[model samples]
Target: MNITYDWNKGVWSNLPLGVKVSKLHKFNALPVQFSGSYEYNFANAAVVPEWSVNLTVKLLFPM
Candidate 1:
């Protein structure tokens, strides 16, 4: 799931909004797979960062 909104024309309370979510996991015999993401921002601007998180681990090699 993801949603984002951004504006840069003039002052409208510094309109910038963003949201993101992600998840993935697989384990049936331990091939290893995991994923995660989270992000949120509501800009008031000073260098743009409200909240952010991400994690991922995947190890599956079969050829």
Candidate 2:
């Protein structure tokens, strides 16, 4: 399992995106992740919240 925190105090602050944070876990060797973030449109003065879930599988073979 893994978790992360990201903060951008310069470039990203002026864009339509905000802080990006996510968490990842391994289930039976498959990777599953959940992410949530905030969006900001400075020009329009709007804020939006978003979240997502993703699952990934990996194939491995012995050499």
Encode model 2's per-residue lDDT on 17-59: one tens digit a residue.
Answer: 4565667667676666666655544432222223323344434
Cα lDDT tens digits for candidate 1, 1-63: 333344564433233444444445457745766666665555544545566676777777556
Model 1 per-residue lDDT at 50: 61
TM-score of each: 0.26, 0.42
Most accurate candidate by lDDT: 1
> Under the 3 Å rule for N, CA and C atoms, how many clashes does model 2 have?
0
Taking all chains together, the TM-score of candidate 1 against the true structure is: 0.26
Give the candidate number with the greatest TM-score.
Answer: 2
lDDT of every model, 2 decimals: 0.52, 0.43
lDDT of 2 at 33: 67
